[model samples]
Target chain A: MQKVGILGGGQLGRMLIQAGIDFDLDISVLDPDPNAPCKLFANRFEVGKLTDFDTVYQFGQTVDVLTIEIESVNVDALEKLHQEGKKVFPQPQVIRTIQDKRLQKQFYQTHQIPSPEFVLIDNKGQLADHADFLPAFQKLGKDGYDGRGVQKLTSPNDFEHGFDKPSLLEKLVDIDKEISVIVARNESGGMRTFPVVELVFHPAHNLVDYLLAPAQITPEQAAQAEALAQEVMLKLDMVGLLAIELFLTKEGKILVNEVAPRPHNSGHHTIKANGTSQYEQLWRAILNLPLGDTSAQSLAAMVNVLGASGHTGNAHYEGVNDTLGVKGAYLHLYGKKLTKPSRKMGHVTILDQTLQGLEEKIDLIKRSIKVVSK
Target chain B: MQKVGILGGGQLGRMLIQAGIDFDLDISVLDPDPNAPCKLFANRFEVGKLTDFDTVYQFGQTVDVLTIEIESVNVDALEKLHQEGKKVFPQPQVIRTIQDKRLQKQFYQTHQIPSPEFVLIDNKGQLADHADFLPAFQKLGKDGYDGRGVQKLTSPNDFEHGFDKPSLLEKLVDIDKEISVIVARNESGGMRTFPVVELVFHPAHNLVDYLLAPAQITPEQAAQAEALAQEVMLKLDMVGLLAIELFLTKEGKILVNEVAPRPHNSGHHTIKANGTSQYEQLWRAILNLPLGDTSAQSLAAMVNVLGASGHTGNAHYEGVNDTLGVKGAYLHLYGKKLTKPSRKMGHVTILDQTLQGLEEKIDLIKRSIKVVSK
Candidate 1:
């Protein structure tokens, strides 16, 4: 049996465990919390810190291959395991590039990948040196996800309350629609990319509010985006799934924003809309098995079900019955215990034979369901 | 949250766990073996005899709704649970009628459903009394599955090894191609049926060897078969996934063979070939959630991976890599620790845009893969 060890035990880890059953692969997961949603399904569950070198190393030793759910894992431990001949997908190098905004921006510049202009800020002293770059977007180089660890720097006064650690500043460009491209590659370099999807962020939370599959872009734009995403995969020498978040400017230019090494939240719609789900494709690519068909069976829209603000006790979903009554609306709750504002608890994917029909169903779902705390 | 408890933890139970995730429904499972494949995935797992009334009753109390993976479950306990107001799909009464060959045949006759002529035989002494019906097929239905507990009685000499218990004696069916229809219905009487699928049985095991979706038949014949299956569901008042197996004679007549009231193995192809998998449809029907799209997205062929004869030990799959090397061939292993001859371990489903292409791929999967005991 080929054993796979996952670093975190959140919903992504839980879904990966579900997908592992299809391949009959043994899975082991490490999480600090014993009641993590994924613990029940994985073949073996271990409680440990994701960033602890010894814990990550011990976990990696038990599996033939290692992967991760959250990106804040101990990279040095993974690098050590890879050096000892363990298969670490996405490669530690790729994760290193993505884990830090400075390294990621440097990679894009070195490879001539289309991206926004940015400058690395080592400290508050460095911010003054680049004072000309004021009114830029300042993002912490590490430990940032889902719109956290980021701020808009309008002047030197902003540096007084800025992050104590190093950060990167990027020129803010006016965006048309936030888009993402998910691609999978095998060890043999065979690549497959799903249709590009446009993301609409929640006005206040800045989290994905909704996703539109096969983003309504011109043929030329779609072709260019796809080519660029595939090229990035090849350049990174990545195996398994890679999700590239991009910014499409009003001027019709595409710029790379960031990339996730594993199955990203952006590709969750593929579970219901495409021939082969992103989880299944990730398994196939990691195992070097032949990939299945990647055609879209229908147009799909995905809406994130985050915890309603100010309700933070035990979790309770109101209007669940009404939501289920909607035609073609599929709900997935992450089996979470507590609910907090802006916390991801679950998601709903609405699929239809046509895009317009899906949009209508999505609108109904948006109005019908509320993920609250009781 | 509404919890569902399933009896029998096999591949069907495993697939139910996957669907349960999408529905955000909690599921518990009961199986005699502690290491049943679904034990690790279900929210709760209890090891007890499926036919033990007390064990089944205790398992039933753990969930709001109850269903079964196989029909051999203890009907008396389920009846008691039903009296207590717990929902048991394919009601205890329906299971009782379907469990016994004699009762099942009588119900069919009473409903005027098309079936072969048959008589009840208690022992060898009774067989001679019905001497005119000599050369009959004797089937002990109560505990029969996958061609077990069935025999072809040619003459009085064939009765030498008579049944130890009462059995159903039916006229031999001159089958052309065996087919099955999976019908799903909710408590509200809303129902849907999948396209008829042709079944090719293995020459020795008599188990389904291959299944071709959208059986090659005239549209009129397809509609007739679908209507007949629907009638059976309504007559039984079945409120779950019901799989009706049938025989198509050279005369193009459809004869009802039997029915399975839970997620049947024959519908596994729907996982990849249809808009909604049989697993998801079964969950929706039982929960009274709106049924999903059941239309076939593509033509598909499913080949069962049965353990090879003359080998019984630790399980090991041969030619898995070879089979997986083919495009569009999906292998599903049940995570069984041991393999015995004729035991169903897994299956491979090959899907394509056309039936011809699927057939070609099916042929390759059959030749390349061997499921054998180590």
Candidate 2:
């Protein structure tokens, strides 16, 4: 087995390594935090900044292939490594484009991919010129992640919320629902896709609250979503997993919301719902192996387990026993020591033959379990 | 979460740790082999003799609860730990009884479990005294594993093949299919049985060649098997996973063949086929959490990947890429550094909605993969 190294050893890396173990692949991980989730199981763990070029270069040198769990990793070193013949999946160029919101939106537009209308702004003052683009969102072009560096500007009065740095202001879509399609492309140009899933986000948190697999969409809509995801992946000319978040407008139009170049939160339910998890598909893609079946075996719903409000310090789980008592509920806790408010702690996957049963369990899980500090 | 310790660090321990990662449990393993499979993923790995009293006792002191992956571990140390209020399950007494063939057989008879008739004997000389039981099997009372320490005696002329040490002569039932029902009992006395599975053994090797979930038997027979397994587990008062291997005689009678006090080979397909894997079920049992659902999500067949007959030394997999291309095929490779003929290197699980499709994939997997030397 070839040695595989991952940058940013958080829960995604932890899960990818877990899936890799089945193949007996030798895996190493580099993360700035010594307590990163992958530290315990990775074959080798290097504590270094993922964004530091020298740190990434040294780590990438030790492996035959390199991939990332998060897109914030230093891509220049990755490009150099790829130029020198080391395999880097979702190639550095793709990562570089996805890392900047401006480039990501531009890439979609340039490829004729349907997305929301947007205008580039250099500073908060520039927002004054785009008042007609009101009822929009001002998103920083760089370093914005997981609801951060993003603000809704519904009117001229919201101009103060805009970033002073370069940003993109986009008109908001009246979303009927949000959906994600995970697609895997191998080096041989073989591609496979998991069933499209609906993502219902927390109204306040902006994080996925729960998701249903085999999203309740018409066959034509499902086909449209899959085709759009494939198109995005093909345009990037990428080899790896791509998570395409899309919004179905109330007017019956599908628009690309944003794109994640690596394993995204939307695909986590595949660990138990699909024949092959997104993590495993990433491995197959990066290794140039055949992509696995992406069909869902049963209806599944996943609820993210975030740290409870006003909780900090060593993490403790409450009602785990009771929650597990629910039939078909599978709990996964990322082995993190702390539990700060709203931090991604873990998730629970609920599998049921019927969507109603799945929804019932999801509600039960949400009400039963809490990640708190002891 | 309490710290857990496992006595053996083979593939079973490796798998247990893999499942435990989901719960973020702190797990440690004690095994004599420095390169034990669990060494890579266990939170702590101690290279020490599992059968040594001191080593077992010292290892038990480091964890809140202890369990075993192999039956050969030092039971006296486990008994001592249990006496000292440390949790050891299936409980040391259950392990002790299951460890010796003589006691295990006697236990079944005393409890009126539907097992084959057997007679305890002191030596080969005693076997000749019972000519009526000539076609029985002579099984060593202790330290017998896999297919070792057992010989088939068809007539008085075969008495010379019997063991000289204390052993048992068990009457062989008329030929029929073999099946396994895995029952789990938690500390709270909650019990659950995985759907009965049929095991087909290799005629030459006497080990499970492949197995199918939801064994092709009448519902009445399946119920009987589940009832029988539950009866055995309740009688033993064991707290953990118990794999009950039984023979469905030609007369339509189910007879107990043997039992293992930990996760058994018959349940490996559950990792992807069942609602909850046996590994996770075992964790729930020992941890006193509620037993999980054991229903099959999809029909599944598992084929063992043994080391090729003429290959040895540094292990390598042949045709992994091609085999992975098979739809619904899931490969699990134990991280063994070396391979020799007939060594259990890994397994491939083929799942499908129909039994015919599953069997076809199983055959394809068997022909496509081989464990050989580099």
Candidate 3:
């Protein structure tokens, strides 16, 4: 058995280490937060900043392979490690591109990948020149996650109040529906994809609320989405899991919305529904082992359980027994201590054969459980 | 969330902690082995002998509830804790009775539970006096597992070399098939039982090699097995998981073979084939939560992969890729280092909707994977 180290140790890393238990491999994790969920599972927990060059370099030196759960880690150290003949999945180049919104959009455009039109603003001074694109989105180029770095613009006044950091603005694609595809590629270039998933947003919080695997799209549309995802992963040429978020335009055109190079929120349902979960695929992708089956054995629906409004202490879930009483509901808690409004606390996955029945169960779960302070 | 402490840390404890990840609870383990498989995932790991009174009592005091993964733990410490108003699942008396074969068999007899006729022997010197019990089995009363402390007697010569210790001799039942049913009883006595499973043993190793869930039996026979298991659990009067091993004779008779007060090998298939796994059911039982569904969604087959003959040091599996190539096979590797002949290392689970397909897949897996040293 060999040792592997992950860069950021949050819930994604937590689940990844859980998957690693079935494989006879030694795993370690490094995170700045001593209470990070991965600390409880990984063979070793080194509490240090992920972006510090010395810390990452030292951690990378001790493992046979290195990977990341979050993309905000130090890429320069990763490049140095790769130069010294150490294995790094999704190589440094992939991380560099994904960390910057400007570079990600540019890569898609240069590779003839379909995406919405966008322009980069190096600083707030450059925001005024992009006033022509009034009704667009301003996204920070780096170090942003969840729903944090995105702002909708309607006039020049909104642009004046935008972040001074490097950013990109793009016209919102006229999407009829949002969908995602998770693809796994091994070091040998063996690639497999999960069934496409449909994402429905919560209007009040603007976060993804409902997701359906084996998205209810026509066969032709499913084929088109899978093909686009394949092209994107092949172009990236990274050895790991990639989640491609895409938009189906009202005119029936598919456009790449954004790209993530590690385990993403949309793929969590795979742990319960697919033959090989996205986390396990990432393991195979790194070990260069045979990728297990990526097919979904059943239809699944997912709902994100966020921290309820006006709660800010130790986290406690209410009505868990009631929500669990609903048939076909399974939950995964992150084991985080503090809960703030709209913070990602945990998620519930619902597996059912009928979409209508799954929807009804999802409704029952949403109304029953609430994450709040005791 | 409250913390629960497990007394032993082997593969059973490893699987229990894996199941705990989904629930919002803190878990710890106390095992003497520094390299116990549970050293990583548990919230706390105390490296102390399970039989040492002070060590067990100290560990028990830190958690709200105490349970056991193996029966050899210190029961006196559990009794002391129970007197101190702490919760110990299965209670102290259950472990004490189940630890000794004589007491366990007597418990069954007093409760009118159907079992093979047996007589207790104070020592090996008294073996010959029971000539009427010729052609029977001599089993040591305590501290025996996996084919150890058990002997078959067919003549006077066999009894002459029996163990010189407290033991019991029983009439060997002619078994048509061996089956096991797992029953869970909560604090309020709410109970549930999983479908019966048939176990097949390997001739050369004398160990269970293959298992099939939803055992192929007449509906009437299945009902009888379930009723027997329910009676055994209710008599034990414990709040935890109980696995009852039973034998169906050639004359259509059911006899209780033995009982395990924690998670058992025959229930492992629940991880893949049932709506709720035995590990999860154990948590629900101890926590006094409403029990989850136990219906088998699909027929499942399992094959044990033991260490090959004449192999030791550093475990490495051969042909895992090929075994996993089977359409529905799932592999679970116990992170054990040493490999000895016939030592249980891991298992492969195959799930299918049809019995014919499941049998074929089980055969493919059995011939494909071999556990050995690198």
Candidate 4:
């Protein structure tokens, strides 16, 4: 019966609301967009800047527990609310540490977590001093999201692509595959991890293009990935879902790439493919309830439905009927009204008993669906 | 996208909204209760009487298609809407027949569908003329719902229990097991049926208590049950979800007991246990989209969380946390505010790869959870 509030009512908040409805949870959402996806669905919705101290603090006062779908929220307000006896999941300090790439790297280094080596830089001018760290990626210390604020710097000639403010130069790893492990921790310190998922990124968009659950890896590798994810979550001392992206180096090392403090794209297939979905897990963690089983029900694949190129107007899904025709394909449209090239329109989760079946259907799904504008 | 309007906004409508949200379908609902379950979540909600001619007629004009979660709506309005080109699924005529017990029985007999033998009666005085049909059930011609408006007659002394209006005296079958098969048909004639589910009724309340999917029946029996359900839907010319409740007589004959023209409690487990949920199938059928695969993802059972016998006030769920601790247990609260004795508060679905695991968990769930007034 707890009144829960969420910051940022985009697709993640929308999906969380879908899961929360099952438990009849009283959920409210605050998003700056009056036309947010959760605008029409949330029990109560208030349009306000998530980073405005007064806006967030006032919103926090109306709910028993507060959480976020995005990480760029006003942490100071959350800290004040936490001190005021309201439950703020993922913890204010955890959010603050993750809000900055430099702090996140430092936390990993301080904990001896096997993440990629990194050096903090104050501005683009400092890139020259880190020439020895060439071939690294420069990521903005804050305000970056969904692959937007990181640029590859192979040499001094690429320095112009580096962030001009507080940032970090992260040494690129020789990755064989990119995988993610989603872990959940409750207030009681109960932790659980979903099956490791293999991610395939869009070449140009730097976003997850498609992913396979129970990533093709030896049990030892999976256990190691799960263990590393758990170590990072425990070290952060966070309560809620955490998505840890990792690099499976050619040398067979499981090195941490980055971590998201909430449900991540890697786990979206869980709604249909796992024993419990990440969205449901978030609710359990924030509500201080028992965590759910994270076992995969079957081999599954998720393909993001990005907006079709050259389309930008009222959204009209092409081939949705055909996609629905494919057996085991579950379409989840975010209810967004417009379409712009590469925008996250929705996703489809395909389930099958065999890896071969999954591979074939995923190919068909990728070729058949497009989000265009009318 | 086509707009959809629902006649009622109770649990069934709430669930349909959940499924519809996945497809980003535009949905609206009209229920007399301002606090209807779908009020907070539906794309649009209007507080209007579903049985009011003006309310139902005017409401139907605002959507591309109209449907119902309950059958006691203004069918005359729907009939007019259907004639005027708006899609009224289950068809107004189907609702008309199914709404009256006498008409439903006659339709079955006329279609050569195997069902309980029955004789139409004009009043309670006519019951004495059918002494040979003693121990039969006298169902009122209209307005009978759940277990109400129906009474058992075993002798002349029980004639007082019969309705004074038009009714039917149906010979009760030598019952063994009660089962349901949900069938879906679309505008283009595409049809699909979910696995047969065995139902256990509450002895005191004529409602389904719990059910097991792929009901513990022989393959031949299962097929026969499914075929009978299909026959009923085909005869009714229904386009949408139809829940066919059948009586598996002691002789192993499958006889039609009754039918509901929308999602039923027997198919609730499909939400998590099947490849496609009944709620989703309803949307597919109504939208003229391809029917989804109805294969069971795993062996599953659902137990309704009814309000405790002595409770009647604002509702509070007890032991939800404990019930949640059981692996594979999925809780779905209906969000109803009151706790009346025998009222359906919610349901918990238990899934497992083994039947024994489901049976054991069902017992535990039945014991641990209680919906009470607080």
- Let me know the DockQ for model 4: 0.77
Q: What is the TM-score of chain A alone in each candidate?
A: 0.96, 0.98, 0.97, 0.97
True contacts kept of each: 0.59, 0.76, 0.47, 0.77
Which prediction has more favorable lDDT, 1 or 2? 2
Scored by lDDT, model 4 comes in at: 0.91
- Cα lDDT tens digits for candidate 1, B261-357: 8898889999878867899888889888777778887788888888888879888888877787777778889988788887889998887877678
Clash pairs detected, candidate 4: none
TM-scores, one per candidate:
0.95, 0.97, 0.96, 0.98
What lDDT would each prediction earn against the true structure? 0.85, 0.91, 0.88, 0.91
For residues B300-321, could you state the per-residue lDDT of candidate 2 as single tens digits? 8988889999999999999898
DockQ values per model: 0.58, 0.74, 0.58, 0.77
Candidate 3, superposed: residue stretches over 4 Å from native: A202-207, B202-207
Give a tens-digit lDDT track for model 3, residues A1-374. 68999999998998898888878778899999998877776789999999999999999999999999999999999999999999999899999998988999999999999999999888988989988887999999987788689999889988668989988998877888899999989898888888899997878987677999988899899899999999999999888999999999999999999988999999999887887789988998888877878788788998888899999889999877777666667788888888889788889889888988998888889998899987
Q: For residues B159-234, what per-residue lDDT tens digits would candidate 4 score against the true structure?
A: 8767899999999789899899999999999999999999867789866667998799999999999888998888
- Model 2: lDDT equals 0.91
